[model samples]
Structure formats: structure tokens, C-alpha cells
Target: MKTKITLLMFALLCVSTLANAQKKQKALSFISGKISIAKYHEREELNRMNKGELLDLYIERIEVIVNILPNIAFATNSNVTMSTLGIPDTKENRKALVENKEASDVYFENTIEFQKKILPYSDTSDLIAAILFYESTLKSLHTYNDFKSN
Candidate 1:
């Protein structure tokens, strides 16, 4: 009987532990979709938006992503780029985001810096979620290329 009680308590503890363990947030993919839509839906007009406008849009999305990141995207959002983060290099740019190895490398380098600042405040799961969004945004950027530049 004592063994049975101990086993039940152990099981309860395990269940609680699992429940409390870091769970990945859900909005990363959503943020990715937003970034993709913004980048791909319109290839040309995207460039006309002023830097402040562009940054504001990004900030809006990042704010939403950040709200979901730690419990988050600002501290870790510095590595944003024209290709990797789904922004266009130029009005006629036709580059891919994730598939473009060079672009991805540059993006990763930038993101690493943000991670350093964010890591002290967040868990692995949170960062992974942010990364998923980053990758998704990259994949989405390939949707359409208005014109190719040499």
C-alpha cells in the first residue's frame, strides 16, 4: 500500500513537471505568414514605403511576435535584412530568403547578436519559436520576384 501511494505521488510529480516545462509558443508561424504576405504579395510597391513606415510595419509584427515570444521579438529583431527577413533588396529584387544560402548566412549572423541579448531573458523554446518565424518569413519571401537584377 505504501508503495502504491509513493508511486501515485511520483506520477503526480512527473505530470506536474511535464506540465510546467517550457512549451513552445504558437504565434511564430503566424508572424512568418505575415512577413511572407508583406514581402511576397506585392513585390514592387514594397520598396516605396519609407524606412520609418517599413520599420513601423516590422515593429508592429515584431511586437505581436514578441508578445508571444517569452511569455517576445525586439531584442532579437536586429538582424532584419532585405532578403532573410522578407524585405526586398530593391524594387526589382528577385532573391530568395531561406533558399538563398548567402542571405540566410547574413541573417543568422545578425540574429545571433539579438539572441545574446534575448537569451538572458528567455528560454530555448521561446528562441526556437522566434527562429521558426524567421525561417518561415524567409520561405515566404520567395513568393514572387517582380524583376531580376544582374
Candidate 2:
């Protein structure tokens, strides 16, 4: 009984640690509203949650991506901003975003880059992935390589 209890406690502690580690909230303020999103972890803990909890998180994520579909659809040109937020929130990220030091700036100044190679005439799904790439934990230059692999 003591062994079982000890194992359960250990598991709980591990989960709490992971949850704490995974917390990254990025908020965007616009005239319409404020969006403070706790982005999806790369490990995909949603699968462990109950159906309702899964749906809630999934829907919030999807809603953010969904709203931006029109923007993607109407894109008249190519752009790839390496920063998660178009503007950098910190001095370090600002350097990466501003000096145009990122790998993609070799392509354009206004656009955001994708970790995965997007085919020509990339459609709505591609656009969604690109935006979600910014709003993800993998905000580094190599964003969404996992998404592409999976």
C-alpha cells in the first residue's frame, strides 16, 4: 500500500512539474478584444485530458487559427515574420525579429517563415499551420518541424 501511494505521489509531482514547465502565455491586444493564449505544448498533453477538457482546449486553439483563415486566403503575396508575434516582446527576440537575422529574411522582409516547407499556392490549412506556428511553444526558427513530421 505504501509503495502504491508513493508511486501515485511521484506521478502527481511529475505532472505538476511538467504543467508548470509548459506554461507560456502570449497575449495580443487589438481593438476588437484581447487574446491571452496558453499555447499547445509540443508534447500534446490534450490527449490525456477528458473529452470536455480536450474539446475546450482544442476549440480555443482552433478558434484562434480559424479566425485568421480569411487573412491567409486573401494573401496577395508571400511574407514570413520569424517572430511568434510580429513584434518582438523582448530585447533578445527583438534582435532576432528586427535585424532580419533569421533564415527566412533571405526571402522577404514583411513575411513570416515556416519551419516546414510550404508548397506553392499554399491553401487555408497551410496558412493556419503557419500562424499557429507563431502562437506555439516552438517559437524558434525551427517551428513546426514536428507538426510537419507528424
Candidate 3:
């Protein structure tokens, strides 16, 4: 009887662990999809919005993604990337938040510098600003993974 109870508890633990892992995997894929959409807009050459309008739209889009990442519990060894996350880069995923697109690179350097300062504060705006400046956040995450492996 003791042996049977131990086996049953072990099996249940394994099942729950697998379920949690699956959820994290789904979140990772969703992050990849958002990154792809952001990249698509960044490449648009003909957007006609003025500067203020463009900045507001960029912030709105990035804030949503930043808010999502912290809720997820990723494994220490998990590798983040578009390919590894397996989220398809599709026009269907493109979300145009503004009439005119602005390049994040215009303030990318400044964004990084500001992020470092506000990181200790753990404010929402700081997190969003850090992620917004990445040329490709997914790619940068992958590069971090590579750095870790080395």
C-alpha cells in the first residue's frame, strides 16, 4: 500500500510539471508574435504621422508586451527566440497602433541609458522603455541565451 501511494504522488507531480511547462511555452510564443509585429511596423517606409503621435503609438504597443512578460515564469535554461518560440511571423499578427510609424532607433540609445537607471525602480514605464528600444527583443533574448551557453 505504501509503495502504491508513493507511485501515485510521483505521477501526479510529473503531470503538473508538464502542464506548467506547456503554459510557459505558449507565453514565449506569444511574445515572439508581438515582437514580429513590432518589427514589421518599424520597417514601413511611408508612414506619415508627426513625431508626437508616433511616440505615443510606439509606447502603447510596447507597454502591452512588457506587461505580459513579468507574469510568466520562464525556466532558467529556457532559450528565447523567434525560431525557438515557434511563433510565425505573419501579416495577420501586425498591429498598427498609429496612423504614422516612427522608428524606435531614433531614441534607441537614450532608451537604453534610461532603462539602466530605472531598472532598480521596477516601474512599468521603465520596463516598457527598455523593451521598446530593442531592434528585435526576441533576437536580443536569443543572443543572451547564447551568451549564457558560452
User: Per-residue alpha-carbon lDDT of model 2 for 30-99, expressed as tens digits?
Assistant: 1111123465444344334444443344445444443333233222112333232355555575454335
lDDT of 3 by residue, 95-118 (tens): 221111123333444564674465
Q: Give the TM-scores of the predictions, in the order they appear.
A: 0.23, 0.26, 0.27
Ranking by lDDT: 3, 1, 2
Whole-model lDDT, model 3: 0.43
Model 1 TM: 0.23
Off by over 4 Å in 2: 1-36, 42-44, 73-150
Model 1: runs farther than 4 Å from truth? Answer: 1-114, 146-150
Which 10-residue window of candidate 1 scores lowest in summed lDDT?
26-35
Q: Lowest summed lDDT over 10 consecutive residues: which window, candidate 2?
A: 27-36
Q: What is the C-alpha lDDT of each candidate?
A: 0.43, 0.42, 0.43
